[model samples]
Target chain A: MIHANDEPAVPMGLPLPNGKLAMWLFLVTEIMFFTALIGSYLIYRNGQPTASQPWPTPHDVHLAEWIGAVNTFVLICSSLTVVLALWSLHVGNSKRAVQYIGVTLALGCVFLVIKAYEYQQKFAHGILPGRVFEKLDSPHGYKYMRHVQEQLEHIEKHGGVNDKAKKACAELLADIRAGKLQPKDVNERVRGTKSIKETNPGKEFITTKDSTYVDLPERSRPKDAPMVEGILEMDTHAHLSYSIPFGNMWASCYFAMTGFHALHVFGGLVVFAIMLVMAWRGRFGPQNAQMVEVTGLYWHFVDIVWIFLFPLLYLV
Target chain B: MSEQHHDHSHGDHSHSHGDHSHGEHSHSHGGDAHGHADDAAAHFRSYIAIFIALCVFTAISFVFNELVRGGIISPMTSATVIMIVAIIKAGCVAYIFMHLKADWGKVYCIMIPVVIMCVMMIIVFLPDGVLGWR
Candidate 1:
């Protein structure tokens, strides 16, 4: 241990212990960094179009809020464990400190694992951002593409949709009118072209010779939806798509903010694991214990940032 | 050696300083093992209390979010309530867990200015159609 008798108590006019002031200053800068990202998210959330009164129907972000809530609890638990680690080390219980830090690190991994799973779900639904954003296979778009995927699968299995598929195709015309369309009322909006009210179970949709029809002018066109001579074709293999109201900008902000936050959690997890090892090796004795305290400050800061981030992104 | 024994209240701190000395072997809080063990138990208790409080607050925020979505509460009011609760939760973590209550001086200078900059950034960087000022 460094000799306490050698070093002066106060290095400057700043009334703080060694490295404490520096750490706080660094955290303050982090506050500014995250503030910029979160502010943009707030603005985007406020400005994004709602599902009500759909004109140019925007992509309503319907993510699994349950996952977000669970992650929040996980982060909170990790924060508690981190503080407990510092407490254990402070009291000269190095073994318990190691235990607590281990828990904190494990919880951090759990949070990331959940985050990765959520990202995978979004990828499957084609929920992407900016230039690569594909509204055609968006969650809403997937709903519209359900029949097409089934028909394609049928064709692959038995060489084309059969009687049931053709019957299903014939019934879908009830929803389509080859002209300009409007919602019946302010509360009413077209989610998809109308199919028959009753189901033809186990039926495959088949496109007949006269099955081609012009698409009714939609509120919005997805990037990948195809049109031939300004007319939407009836082939279920492609063309039909769904879109959110003003989806692109929202996707950009959500991905950027949450993505960066997850990265920070990963970095903290590594740091905590190292510190856990240090504690077990008897390096975090009270005289030189400021490292554990400082890192705890950082982990807590990450937790605090998420405290604000949780409601802002998922709830609000 | 004295500095090594100075962290009397690491987890459940009260910030009561004992005239700090740069001299060797000036004090010893680690001399009392049994007393320290009792104190450790106390500290863990407080940690448990704080964790429970944080969890309850989190649940409340989730409930409020659902209420806002269901239109049981006005959106603006719900937002206000959630932010206020978030601030409180952050306070507990910063003070109790991070031990910021034991700190002052340079931290305040750094913190106060950064907070001001945060508010300014929000106003300046707000995106289009938020206030229709665009």
Candidate 2:
């Protein structure tokens, strides 16, 4: 009969405990899963034509690098806490272990909150996949033109413009409906107004019912003042058009990669919560300290994934 | 023989009890008590050092990206430096924080095949997908 003093039996020729080995196996599969996602992202990113549809940088898309950096720091700190929790368990300090796990869980929550905020910013700017625009001739451009028309109608209803200006707006709306004037035309008109404003410091361009004129003294009119006034006569009220070249593909890759990663973080938080409860119950010690170590392995893998993701998504 | 028997008794006692104190067990194990304490201290110190290193690496990557944005450096240079730094940071976390260094033999056995598989995936996909090859 096997006695209490007998050496513990090795399972499947592995020195590690069954649970620890199993966790490592699970992590290996997870690594492969993430690798596949990142690989697809790179393929799509590299396959695009730079001349026709240049990939949008994070700055171009208004994604702040500092936010991603801060989140990376947070995850690194959580990794430390998780390892420290396992260390505390090994030393028989279950209280410290529980505290460390609690901190790690809280840090995970902070990361997700920041990520959600970034997503909210993207949604507010209409940067979602399939809805991004690079030119004013596409479907999204027409939609934006309609939006501008609505805003102009709202302004006219509120007596925001003179009768002549209101009539000009009505004609502009008719041209927009007939597809006679594109957003590019409006954009060029707005650009012209800005240039005129820059060149003539004291003069103000006023849009009247019939024509646009410069509010300048008769004796002080520059030689180019009439030409500037004529240029500014075109409707420039629809200056809301913007472009994000290849933003649809960029959004697709960004959301898929980071979204999966955030989901993994959430999964880690759930496991950490369970570990915290176990620590509170005094379930960890040298006798079963391997349990904490196994859990820490999973948490560290999640951190390592983010370590790669932070650079790939934000920096590059 | 007698010492081994005593150690077994302690192990069995801890296993049978609901509130086993690992610190007390190590304390009762003579020279192992001091060795375990020293090892634990070293591990704790290493964790702190790694945490600082990770923070510094993250800062370096951020700065490199800023340089690229300012047009002081090329995007390729920034990408290369950032990816290298990321690899180093990941290595630190995996080796130290994950205890892969302590159990290198066993864990490497599990990791090597996965590494090869990941490499194969990249090799097969990069050429066809990235370079526009059939």
Q: What is the TM-score of chain B alone in each candidate?
A: 0.64, 0.76
Cα lDDT of model 1 by residue, A250-270, tens digit: 567767878888988988988
**Model 1: CAPRI class:** acceptable
Model 1 ranges with Cα > 4 A deviation: A1-13, A48-59, A131-241, A277-288, B1-42, B125-130
- Per-residue CA lDDT of model 1 for B1-57, tens digit only, reads 222232333311312222221111222666665655665576677678888999999
lDDT of 1 at A299: 88
lDDT of each: 0.59, 0.70
Q: Candidate 2 — which residues are off by over 4 angstroms?
A: A1-11, A134-140, A147-180, A185-241, A279-288, B1-27, B128-134
| Candidate 1 C-alpha error for residue A269, in Å | 1.2
- For model 2, how does the per-residue alpha-carbon lDDT over A29-67 read when each residue is reduced to its tens digit? 999999998888777777653323345667546588899
Q: What local lDDT score does residue A21 receive in model 2, on the 0 to 100 scale?
A: 71
